[model samples]
Target: MAAEMTVSELVRRARDGQARALGRLISLVEDGSPRLAEVAAELAPHTGGAQVVGLTGPPGVGKSTSTSALVKALRASGRRVGVLAVDPSSPFSGGALLGDRVRMQEHATDDGVFIRSMATRGHLGGLAWSTPQALRVLDAAGFDIVLIETVGVGQSEVDVVSLADTTLVLLAPGMGDGIQAAKAGILEVADVFVVNKADREGADQTVRELKYMISLGRREKGPSWRTPIVRTVAARSEGVDELVQAVTDHRDWLIEHGELDARRVQRAENEIQAVVAARLRAEMGELRGGATLAGLAREIVDGRSDPYRAAEQLLADLRS
Candidate 1:
């Protein structure tokens, strides 16, 4: 039924609050379907409505729990929320290993909440290859806030910074996250720092370390905004409201400092570059399978042409 549904019908139903239609649209994105361009075109006008918030950190910091807490908080405030939980892929089937619906069973029946788990599929930066397009589908579906929970692989989750309006770096006590965060170069990308499991022992010490790090690594010039630290015991829903408030404050600051539009522009630029690169890679694969690359290799093997010259010929073929 979904495959038979036209892109217009899907977009229309999605805008009319049809979850099935929204799911199908995102499925097209994830599978790299032939209709992806049509789906994107249909959803373009409705894009940029939802605020994209990204949560990333090392494993065992309770990111999933905190995301559920955040969904509850946002829903309580009468906001429709969508969550994209990027989970590790199952080696056999290449599907999401952890299903968020099991963890966040409370929100399963809520009409205003939509949760999806996307498998990383070994893509770097702790996100799936199609996350940006999935976010577009959710945004066009009219969710007020879209939360992206990255695969927590410690240092490499910083790609969320490019996509989110506000990026939260979650840490926990006894994780040595402060030093790890600095080493990962994620400290500079964080807009707000969340210290989850704040009730645990050594929580204050963790907070102090983060504060010291933040002070030392403050940006020289940009939005002139200060990153706020919020502590939370996500299991108990403690300090969640303050975290929400901090998110609100950051959004307001972005708008006030005219950084929101700038960020979105950069996001668009990156998306375009990604598409171009993907297309080029596909063409290069075709070249490798065809006689062109084989002939070039034979020439290089026979000492008839150098590698650099053969590369130039390949570039010319690509241009043509």
Candidate 2:
């Protein structure tokens, strides 16, 4: 049997830059370990130092390539970066394909970078259920910047806005992505709008369409800030410096406008609410008979009891 380790050892080793230990801590979080509470309490003091930035968009928008480019740019400035690439889960085993990790192999030997791929496990909104806790592990491990790359789920992917201090929405030319973006409500969530693959033919037209859409005031994301449009050919590393600068500018703007603290507070609030909901779900599942839930549904379907009353009965059973 493997030796049991203490939370202190894990925390200390992870903070000292042991990538294996850090990965183990994140696994503990993902597995919902019994010692998770202890680990979280131990790491609480070390977190809140890293900047959490989320990159999200429709599928084929070059999020992974852009993330790798950003890592190269940020590391050039002497910052330690961590990447959380959330991928769609396999239906059979619920495991991630880890495609992003493979794409980011150039950084495999770089000690300053850590890349992890997580499975969404059928979770909608492009993020895994354990993602917030995993992010905490990265934050506590002393990463200067944490980039969360979500699965490409189109409109429902707005949950990243709640988790990230800054959200970058990427689009590409030749995809009719500008119109699709407006229809999908993607424009409202962007702190920086990146037009990746800018070498394509419709690049200028896409930029003009996005600018026109932004000017319509359909989504008022900032009262004092204008979300800047950035062009980048991430595969060639073209415009990456400008993209990174745009991200930096947005971070600075958040600090200046008092939105940083407010956003963090909101993130904590969301985490707390999600935890409570999950706990309640588990608690409700512990009712005396597992079939009681199905029985309740059957009763509702048979018109013997309405859904409102059936839900009340479930709560009553829980209280008892």
Candidate 3:
């Protein structure tokens, strides 16, 4: 067992590159301890320094490849990068392949790059339950850029927008139907759009279709904030510099318009809500006694009482 460390000591050790301390701090957050709020308050001053970029798209759209290429480009410009690749968990084994980390081999040994793979564990949002804390760990550790990749199962992964300063939605050449299906959610959240595997046939058509969709939406425009679609063949590192420029341009626009600070404030509020909801659920579970609650759930399922009434009774018991 690791020695018990106070929140301040843990924060100091984590800043000093103590992996054990960092891991413990993340665990505290994951478990929804009140200490997490304390830690977040202490670390808020250190967080806005990092630019968080979220990447999400359908499976097999070359998201990991694109992420690796972007990280390589950013590193070449002398920036420290942190990657959090969120992989879907296997139902039977509860483990993830983390194929993204394997594809990012170029940075495997670089100390300036820290890559971690997280299993979603059925979290409703694309982010893992541990994500906010993981981000805090990276922020405290002093990474200038943080990239988050999510397994895109297509049902509103817009939660990424709440966690990241900018979100890049990746689409491949043959994903026109998928894009059409996800347009409302994807287009609403993405600060920029990336068409990977652009060397493939039909890539231009996809870009045109997306542009048309964006034009149909009614919104106040300021300084040409139209979401620009950049094409890239990430496998070969083609067009990466242009994509980087697009990302930088978007960040610059946000900062100039003062939206960056507004977005960060919104993100902090979302994180607080997520943390509180998780803690309330966990405490409720403990109060009910896990197995006993499971038994009550079975009773409700068997028609003993309506779920709402049962839940109310359980809440009364918890309070008593």
Candidate 4:
């Protein structure tokens, strides 16, 4: 469908708030279309405006519920919101499982809200590889806020930090989340800790544990933010306004300390590196099936040549 529209035309329409055009542009990004570079070129100037927020945690922490509540809160303030809910891929379809999409259907008819479910496609980082590019599409489409809800938190899921301006790590009372947070290194990446399902028992204990951990973490010798913990029963949208305020406060802190620019610069660097890596992989596709690489592998396996020398030979052949 995107093939029917020129990248410039799609970008223009998306900026005009045409939902279909915005969806098409994101689809182009998701599918890694040949026109993706052109789409990026058009989107580049219009970006760096939206506040990117990431919500992540172990599964069943009400991340989807919290995201929905946040969208409601943002829309009440008349800010256009974009949500990227990265879902685990369906084994048969290789597409989003649509769990988040199903839960957030209340906003489906809200013109100010755009919710997209992205399949991780087996990406280890709990995000679709195309997510940064998708964020560009949303930013260029004039969203005031973008919320990225990762597939789930794990050792490898903190990659969201590289993209978000404020990362809200959600935890539930009964989930052993405090221990999991410590194991996953989430304490380092969390800008705000949200204990969703706060009405449940053990909620206070979770909060206490988080505050203790926060106290233990060392901070840089400069203006530093003591991460705040907010409690919420996301199912009822309770405490969501306070959660929103916490995010705003964190954003304010980021701006006041001149850290927003620094973070964005780092984000751009990560995006650049990802692009370069993807390009290299594409260029190396030939070596994957070519005799040069196979020969190198055979040599290494047969002990005829060391792995380092075989790698060197493969690179040399690739160069030629």
**TM-scores of all candidate predictions against the true structure:** 0.90, 0.93, 0.83, 0.91
- Using TM-score as the yardstick, the better of models 1 and 2 is 2
Worst 10 residues of 1 by lDDT: 120-129
Across residues 88-185, which tens digit of lDDT does each residue of candidate 2 receive? 43445544544745755798788899988877543222243478888999999999999998754553356655689999988899876555666766
Candidate 3 deviant stretches above 4 angstroms: 1-10, 16-42, 89-105, 121-128, 154-156, 176-185, 218-224, 288-299, 302-304
The lDDT of model 4 is 0.81
Ranking by TM-score: 2, 4, 1, 3
lDDT by residue for model 4 (1-320), tens: 65687899999989888888988998878777788789999999999999999888877788878998999998998999999886543435645545644755687677888888777553222243588889999998899999988855454356655589998988888886566657766667788899999999999999999888877866341278888899999889899999999999999999999998999998888788788767655555567566666777788889899988977776676678
Please state the error at residue 148 of candidate 2 in Å.
Answer: 0.5
Best by TM-score: 2
Task: At residue 251, give the lDDT of candidate 2.
Answer: 91
lDDT of 1: 0.82
In order, candidate lDDTs are: 0.82, 0.82, 0.74, 0.81
Q: lDDT of model 2 at residue 114? A: 91
- C-alpha lDDT of residue 33 in model 1: 82
Q: How far out, in Å, is residue 2 in model 2?
A: 6.9
TM-score for candidate 4, please give it.
0.91
Backbone clashes counted, model 3:
0
lDDT per residue, candidate 3, 217-244, as tens digits? 7534345687888989999999899989
